[model samples]
Target: MSDDPLPFLDGPWRLSMGLRRLEPDDWLRVDDAHDAQMRLRDRLLAERRAEVAAALPGSEAGCAETLALLLEFLPERFPERWTRDGQVMVDRRNGRRVALDGEPPLVIAGRLVQEDLCLMRKGPDGYELSAAVLCFPSHWRLAEKLGRPMAGIHAPVPAFGERLGPTVDRFMAGLDADRPVWRVNWSITETDELFLPGDRAQRAFDPAEPVGSGLFLRLERQTLRRLPQSGDILFTIHTSVRPLGDAIVRPDHAAALAARIREMPERMSRYKGFHLMGMPLLAWLDRLAAAQVRVAAPG
Candidate 1:
């Protein structure tokens, strides 16, 4: 649904690689259909409130701090569309509005924004997830991850321990309120579903032309910022899923994705669920490459 054709086509294998700083203006992206997305999020909240939203008894301060930030940041970042004036918060971009009087933090967060909110507090063992309101999970269960430290939550990710674990610890500890940073990750899936939990099978997987019509590119635009009051870091995850076959309008996007998948390590391929889908994807890219060569040939 994002008009961004090549959202994850950032050169080779984008992992937990870049932690570039984010300006206040860039805190959130108000892509198309914000209201509809928020409505979908609210429905998910109503149906799976206990599953998608959670908070610890000791998570009050950090959750409150994060809620405050969203109240002030949403309108500031998207002035034209997101306005919080008087007793009403209006999202003109999506043509949706909500009152400001007595909504719960998770409800307000879920209704007003698209990005899932997670509060991370630093304890003896490092940063642990204190609270979260995640509606669009790629394949992980939010209830199972609550109160766990960063390393525990990421245990399934291959090479995260030896490769990016220490670096992530340092980053979380050193992150400041004045400086927010973000990184991107890419996964090719058999389905286009946005709410695929690890427990459920992907209904979008197609054996025929798996890479052509069945493949979807799922990209997560993740950001981190330290809460001014609680000193806890707030992690935000924004997920986008679009058809790869449709997105490869230009040759370069396909070429970049092909190169990244072609060279990705075996461990990472397994972790990303790419190993099963790799050969078909490569074949699709190969066809595109061969077609381009033919187009470029002289008459």
Candidate 2:
């Protein structure tokens, strides 16, 4: 029923990958969406600063100065290259990338200066391209796990659903006529355990893709609750819908993406990816909870 070229049910891997990568046209469509988001954030930050300044209008106290002073006492007090203007020149490390804005730009809450900041880079078409993603770490991880990284991914945690609709709209609008659009979704589960099956963990794996062997283990509800309390890990899942050889949801594709995610006893994120692609809410949770169970007790 949907006119989308990449049907919600199937596999044109190239198209799927393209959806994740932003195209030039997409940028123009979502330009305002991104701008509005940045403006709103700048306003809030400015207001907060004003409120603090109003509270201590005459006080010369400076948090940055105090932090710098404290850092000075450390044995490895190497000079950080902060500009005279207060903008921080933090190294663009391989880990997570954060963006900051005006004034003195420094790391705040493990993110960059500008929360909604985007990056434009040269693409194969010889044109500058842009894409927006969720917050730093989440988007960073998603980008790394995918076959092709998101041209731009930002999720302003400080701002949630407020920007999701606009962000997605802009992303969709920018799709290259030669590419497929990606479907992105997120959810919060009550349980702490998360798992991505070896098969599902690898994005490129197909049914014919050599299947890994494993057995389903049952875990008690009480046991599940105790290992790690709720709110332990923030589960963020990203997927792109592609057209497969014989596209049909009846193969239980929806139920597949909803597979349970359980914390690997020894690993931070390594877990089974139950492909419960399009299942309804309640059913998906039930399967996720059931799919993931406490590791079998040692002898």
Best-fitting candidate, measured by TM-score? 1
- Let me know the TM-score candidate 1 reaches against the reference structure: 0.90
lDDT of 2 by residue, 252-289 (tens): 44333223233112121222223322123324334443
Q: List the residue pairs that clash in candidate 1.
A: none
TM-score, per-candidate, Cα-based: 0.90, 0.23
lDDT of 2: 0.26
Instruction: Give the poorly placed runs of model 1, Cα more than 4 Å off.
Output: 1-9, 85-87, 93-95, 101-103, 200-207
Question: lDDT (0-100) at residue 274 of candidate 1?
Answer: 63
Per-residue accuracy of model 1 over 1-299 as CA lDDT, tens digit each: 44433544655564565767777777777676466667778788878888788888788888777777888888777788888768788877656777766856755676677888888988778999888888888789988888888888888888887788888899888887898887666677777776765753424334476576687777778889988888989888877777887767566666777888777788776666666666767778877767777888998
- Summed backbone clashes in each candidate are 0, 48
